[model samples]
Target: MGDKTDPNTTKIIHPVYIVANIQNKVRILDGKKVTYSSWVKLFKLHACGYKVLSHIDGTTPPAKTDEDYESWSEIDAIVLQWIYGTLSDDLLTRVLEPDSIAYEAWTRIQNIFLNNKGSRAADLEHEFNNLTLRAMPSLEDYC
Candidate 1:
């Protein structure tokens, strides 16, 4: 028999798929003009595609040598690109600087969104309190 490979049985290249389908699909956020509602929607969009975004999280295991620097640099560039690419120019100026780390940038955006208080928060709380399951549905739909 001639040597042949089955394309159907070949392993899928996940990184390519992640880059194309998940990473590229992330919408750029207008951080400067974002309202609470828009911020929440953008946050959910990012959360839904976090697997692609996780490359930017830089969670490699701790090491004692200088060998990891190259890898770390690559991760840092990816994370920084995502951070800068997603923010509006006005907000980008506020959140990032030459010395800022990726984690800090990510955390800053999250804190800005999460620290909401006042009328909007109260209104959302009221709606959440009144929410009920009306009919049979899948768990995702119920949620």
Candidate 2:
């Protein structure tokens, strides 16, 4: 096996976001411009044989606070899970629909991960896992 950082070694090879549009039904731009739908199509085309544009949240969240109860670590783990899960082509795709700001935020996160390949992957992973477990005990199944 070659260096993990090697481009060839990367299993999911594609810029994290070909377009910033993450919301499912909403259009990112006005008119026939770059809507979320368009972005998904573009991403699919560029990703080629690689899987992308998988999960999309089909429903709205139950009433909850807008506050960011999650820490940076938790956010990181969720991002990794989203990417890895999406690559597997098994996770429920409807959970990622483009109308949600949470999805947009997730796209930003994936971009950060792609830009910071040299960063401490293990530390981020640990922090994310811990934070997730603390927030939802049920998540222990995945952790």
Candidate 1 per-residue C-alpha lDDT over 1-143 given as tens digits, one digit per residue, 9 for 90 to 100: 99999868966443423443323554566744556456546644664354334433445433536786656556555556666776777767777877665666776776666675576579889988876777527667669
lDDT of 1: 0.58
lDDT string, candidate 2, 14-128, tens digits: 4433324323322232213543345445434533322333322223333345353333233333433433333312222423444344345446534443455556567668867
After superposition on all CA atoms, how large is the RMSD of candidate 1?
11.0
Clashes of 1: 0
Identify the leading candidate in terms of lDDT: 1
lDDT of each: 0.58, 0.40
What is the lDDT for 87 in model 2? 30
How big is the positional error of residue 10 in model 2, measured in Å on the Cα after superposition?
46
